[model samples]
Target: MLGVVPSSRAPNPFFWLEDTHTNTMEAIAMTIGHSTIPRMRVPALLKGNMIDVDLASLEGQWGMLCCLPRLEFCDAVFLNQFRRAVQKQGAALLGIQHPAHPFLAAHLPKAKILSIPLLTDSAQRIGRALGLSSETHLNQCQSFIFDPEGVVRNKLTHSFNWHCMTLLLGILKQCQ
Candidate 1:
């Protein structure tokens, strides 16, 4: 993807994923990693406010789907990066973690951090949504980018890296 700078040379709405020469703060800050993406239902609980973020609210969002095991979502670096990237996309940052894990706090004081739980589809007869049937899945933190229409536009299955995020950013810019 090529960066689209107008004749005025102002940074356009799009960011190129392949351009390593022109590195910006936005590009530098984005992350590519396999931290557990806590899958959460919309309108979740945070502090005392009613945070509603479900597929309904997330329908028009270009969400990054993350899959993480228990106790791994609390990584400070991963959480912050995920939050920031999602914030930039103006999309819902989702994670699907195993049940019985802690809850993700919007802001934890010191040691109180929660993991986002993924939604379970009872229609198992149709297919395996998480793409995991056995308990021991190797690729845990695979990230998939879904467009505003809920169609997956990009996929990062192995690891998160600068190139991966740049690819995601490129897709996001196209979406915008």
Candidate 2:
């Protein structure tokens, strides 16, 4: 019998799985990860207003996808700053967190994370599919930026910092 490792198995927290994969942030844009956007259209809660992000229709624009462990860690100030940065480059920023329905039901009222649009991945389907799932939780700081043609222009999966954010914004500027 061929034994297959379950993806739910915990990974070593000491190792940064996504960060160590390949340092492609400075590399030229490529089409190596060619999978088209997923077919599901999830709700994006933005400041009490709900919008549907049609992944299939975002064919000709720059976009960013972020996976965070929880919404509570996202403060209003950070959301504002992040949104301003994304807007400056004319890019769309979307986020995903676990148990989307409950999180939205409970915390959406506070309007804390109303800056960027977010999707709920209750089943971790999106996380597992995007290779952002880890032993304990989704890659909190992981992010991916895609070009108008839907090809990945930059991938940042490690810990996020000011320097890395500047680099991400730089890549977005180049995309524009």
Candidate 3:
């Protein structure tokens, strides 16, 4: 089991620890008002190239990480919307999907058209790390907002609708 210790820092109320004796990495359930995102690197596809992106290295700016089961036309549209919103706020936006997803190849062109980096988490490591796998829905859509210090400021999950987009935009505005 991973242990979470209270943090004195205002931005992050709690920090997590890994249990060394266990080979399996324990999932740390992130609470909107209580947890800081853990550091990790993930492979990303950008402009038709694969690269590794360090999540913790983005500590100097506001960033949003969106994880979807797969990429579709609707997902692309929402991603573009998020891209515009984040760019307006001078924040970074990233998307993640399982590499083996059935439609991933077909959606490559759409992803290439987008300016943001799209990550590939083949083993679902990122989702497991964020406790997203615990959700009832398999491969649920989720978005996370992290501040400059890498502390998660907000989290949205399940479906992505206009209302959700509006709420996310409002949160981004407030973050700024």
Backbone clash pairs in model 1 (N, Cα, C under 3 Å; residues 3+ apart or in different chains), count: 16
Better of 2 and 3 by lDDT: 3
Each model's backbone clash number: 16, 0, 0
Write model 2 residue lDDT over 66-141, tens digit each, in one string.
6654555354346557868887777777776544325465345445446777776666666665655453343236
Best by lDDT: 3
After superposing candidate 1 on the true structure, give the runs of residues whose Cα lies further than 4 Å from its correct spot. Answer: 1-53, 73-77, 98-111, 114-127, 130-139, 160-176
When 1 and 3 are scored with lDDT, the better candidate is 3
Model 2 bad stretches (over 4 Å): 1-32, 98-113, 136-140, 174-176
53: Cα error in model 3, Å:
1.3
**Candidate 3 lDDT, 136-165, residue by residue in tens:** 445356778888887778776634555445
Report the number of the highest-TM-score candidate: 3
Off by over 4 Å in 3: 1-33, 98-103, 134-140
* Model 2 TM-score, 2 decimals: 0.64
Q: What TM-score would each prediction reach against the true structure?
A: 0.48, 0.64, 0.67
lDDT of each: 0.45, 0.58, 0.64
Alpha-carbon error at 159 in model 3, in Å? 2.4
RMSD of each: 10.6, 9.5, 11.7
Per residue, candidate 1 scores C-alpha lDDT tens digits across 112-163 of 3432323333333211443433342433345566666666654444234445
